[model samples]
Target: MIIDILAALFIVAGSFFMLVASLGVFRMPDLLTRMHATTKSGVLGAGLIMCGVMLFFVDSGVTLKALAVMAFTTLTSPIAAHAIGRAGYFIGVPLWDKTVKDELHGRYDEETHVLRSPEHMQDKQDQP
Candidate 1:
């Protein structure tokens, strides 16, 4: 009985997070922010839902599959988000107008397609 209740709780929590993530993706002003919502909240929601499903399953095989799915989702979501964000930025996707500053402005050299910090921003700013 307690286990069932626990599983239900996990599912409910997962559902709530998934709903919030969905709303965030639609409401966020920019792609970067939407990525944050999908990567963070989406992962948590999926993991929690998987946990509940794993607990509810009596068969060992089903439980193992659920665990595997949860692990894969947790590990890949952030990496995928990062790749999308980097590609978007590299293709000259604009940030929100209210963005304060871009720390990556001079870091990426198109000639080499590499991002490296050269000591400090102040050092670069001090130069011509």
Candidate 2:
């Protein structure tokens, strides 16, 4: 009876997280943040739900399959998220400007760093 109750609780909790993650994916301002929320919460929510189902069911084969599914999800979710984020960046998805400091900005000379003017060196030295 207690095991059943615990399993129910886990499933409910996992479902809630999954719903929240879906909401976040919809409501987040940018692709990167959405990916962050979806990837982390989706993986954890599915993992917990699978654990709950495994605990609640008595069939060994079903439990093993669920475990395998959970394992695969855990392994691939982050990779998928990373790929999406990289694609977004490559495709020029605008970042939340307030949240990021791009250190790479203006640091390089496209022609050649060695050919930079003395004024550029002076500007760098002037920065405290």
Candidate 3:
């Protein structure tokens, strides 16, 4: 009885987070913010849903598969989101007008398409 209740709660919470993620994608002003919402909330929702599934099943095979899937999602989602965001930025996707700051402003080289750290830029300036 307790297990069922716990599973139900997790499932409901997961569904709610998934809904939030969907809303974020539609409502966020820019690509980066949308990606952030989808990655973080989506991963959490998936993890929680898997947890509920694992609990409800109470079987070793289902539990193992659920854990494996959860692990994969946790590892890949953030990296994928970052790569997409970086690609968008490289291709000149504009940030929202109200953005507070752009940390990558002068750090990225257009010609080489490489991002240099502040220390590296400083060292180059010192060399010349």
- Using TM-score, give the best candidate's number: 3
Q: Could you tell me which 10 consecutive residues in candidate 2 have the lowest summed lDDT?
A: 107-116
lDDT of each residue in 5-115, candidate 3, tens digit only: 999999999999999999999999999999999999999999999999998999999999999999999999999999999999889999999999999998999999889
Cα-based lDDT at residue 18, candidate 1: 95
Off by over 4 Å in 1: 120-128
Over the stretch 1-128, how does candidate 2's per-residue lDDT look in tens digits?
99999999989989998998999888988898999999989998999999899989968997999899899999999999998986776556888776567433454464653334567877889999
Q: Name the lDDT of candidate 1.
A: 0.88
Q: Distance (Å) between predicted and true CA of 17, model 3?
A: 0.6
The total number of steric clashes, by the backbone 3 Å criterion, in model 3 comes to 0
lDDT of 3: 0.95
lDDT tens digits, residue span 1-128, model 1: 88899999999999999999999988988888889998889989998998898778768998999889888998999999999998998889988788788778868888999887767656878999
Q: What lDDT does candidate 2 reach at residue 101? A: 72
**Model 3 ranges with Cα > 4 A deviation:** none
Indicate which candidate wins on lDDT: 3
Tell me the lDDT of model 2 at 113.
39
lDDT of 1 at 29: 80
lDDT for residue 115 in candidate 1, whole number 0-100: 84
Candidate with better lDDT, 1 vs 2:
1
